[model samples]
Target: MRLALAAALVFAGIDHWLTPERYLPMMPDYLPWHLPLVLFTGTCEIAGALGLLLPRTRRLAAALLALYFVCVFPANLHNALNGLTVDGLPQEQWYYWLRLPFQPLIILWTLYAGGLLPRRATAVAAA
Candidate 1:
């Protein structure tokens, strides 16, 4: 799960770089330095993804990545609320609404996969 999440982040980071314009609309108008912010977040995603692979960095990476998700959530909310289109793809209101609730799940998943959360013990059958 950790590796899969890392791969997803890497792919997303690449997408951010490849088509930044697609993400521009997601940025809140009140925010400054849009392009740099996009690039910075993309870089962080890539770095965090790579960090997740190393044992020593895995926990830190997971924590950071979770925070990153939290930080960018507003953009996701904004995109959903405004019915914003991206890369010529038109999304329905329901689509955005559906995505809203998944953010916390992603955070919890990251924490668990990164070993930050306590592992659940399996029950053993009595002989």
Candidate 2:
């Protein structure tokens, strides 16, 4: 799970640099330096992915990534609410709406995969 998440982040980070325009539509008009912000976020994602892989940095990385997710949520909302069809994404409105709920799950996944959250303890049978 951790590896998959790291790989996905790496791919997404690279995509941000390779095709930033797709992300531009998601940015709110009030935000300044959209291009630079997109690039910076890409860098953050890559760094966070790397951090997740390291034992010492896992917790911190997860926390930051979760925060990052929260920070970017407005963009997601703007995209969905405006019905903007970003390049390479499903053009269907339902797809955009469906994605919104997944953000929290992604945040939770980051925390769990990073070992920041305690796992469920199993009940041991008394002999």
Candidate 3:
């Protein structure tokens, strides 16, 4: 699942890299260096996706993936808060608002699948 999430993120990052202008307005006004941000995130997605496929690095990759989500969250917030638009997405605030709740679900899945989340001790005790 983390691998799948990484792949999906790669696609999303590529979209941002491919069209920085479209995403630029959504980036937090306080942030600096859009070019590096776009490039670094694109590279991170690709590297993280590959890392997730390797058992030895899966945990670290998932942690990074979770962090990546947190890092990019401001863009989503900007979109929702300022009515920013993107291609291939519906131009509606409702759509952006609906996207907020998905962050935790996706981040949790990434961590769980990558084994970054510790197994519950209660489950072990019960067994």
Candidate 4:
């Protein structure tokens, strides 16, 4: 799982860098500085990938990453609603559908694998 998350983040970082204009449409037009937002997000993803590789800071790393995903959901929703197209990522239309559910699943898996959450077991009454 750690390997998977790290690999995904690294790849995603590269993708974001290569196609920042694509992300621009995702952000609100009112925002003045889109370039920083793009680079900042990319850097965070790379840092998150590195963070997930270690054991000591795993929980915080996963939490930060989870929050990151949650934050971008609105942009995805915007794309889906407007039927907008983004450069570099041609499949943006379908990506919204693919991206929505995976966020929670990723977060859940990260937390569960990190043992950050308490386990629940069913108890039975002895006769």
Candidate 5:
């Protein structure tokens, strides 16, 4: 799960750089320097993703990545609220609405994958 999450983040970060305009609509109008912000967040994502691979940095990376998800949530909300489309692709309101609840799941996943969460072990019965 940890490796998968890392790969996903790396892919997403790359996407931000490769097609930044696709993310522009998600940015709130009040935010300044949209392009730079996108690049910065993208870089952070990539860095965090790489950090996750190292045992010493996994916890910090997980925490930061989880926070990143929280920080960017408004953009997700903005996309949903404004009925924004990506690359001229129309997305139904339900699609965006469904995504809102998944943010927390992603956070939890990161924590668990990073070993920051307490693990429960099942007791084995004596044979």
Candidate 6:
């Protein structure tokens, strides 16, 4: 799970750098310096992913990442609500709406895999 999350983050971060224009429409008009902010977020994503892989930084990375998910949510919501479109992405409104629920799941996955959350205990059958 941790590895998968890290891999996804790395891919996304690289994508941010490779095609930042894809992210511009998602930016809310109230925000300033969209390009720089996009680049900075990409940097943060890469850093957090790397940190998640290290034993020493996993918890902090997870916390920050969860927060990052929360911070970027408004952009996602805006995109969905306003029906914004980008190249190479789905044109279906349902696809964007479906993505909203996954944000919280990613946050939970990050926290759990980073060891910030307690593991679920399973009941053992008595012999």
lDDT of each: 0.87, 0.93, 0.80, 0.77, 0.90, 0.93
What lDDT would candidate 3 get against the real structure? 0.80
TM-score for each predicted model, relative to the true structure? 0.92, 0.96, 0.83, 0.78, 0.92, 0.94
Q: How would you encode candidate 1's per-residue C-alpha lDDT over 76-106 as one tens digit per residue? A: 8998888886775556678777777999999
Q: Between candidates 2 and 4, name the one with more favorable lDDT.
A: 2
Please tell me which model should have the higher TM-score, number 1 or number 6.
Answer: 6
Q: Indicate which candidate wins on TM-score.
A: 2
Worst 10 residues of 5 by lDDT: 84-93
Candidate 3 off by > 4 Å: 118-127
lDDT of 2 by residue, 18-58 (tens): 99998988899999999999998899899999999999999
Error of 2 at 115 (Å): 1.0
Instruction: Write one digit per residue (lDDT tens) for candidate 6, span 13-121.
Output: 9989999999999999999999998998899899999999999999999999999999999999999999987678898999889889999999999999899999988
Sequence-dependent TM-score of model 1: 0.92
What tens digits encode model 4's per-residue C-alpha lDDT throughout 23-126? 88877676668888987888888888888888887778888887888887777777777777676666656876666677688777766655576667779899
Model 4 stretches astray by more than 4 angstroms? 88-94, 118-127
Give the number of the best model, judged by lDDT. Answer: 6
- Where does the lowest 10-residue lDDT sum fall in candidate 6? 84-93
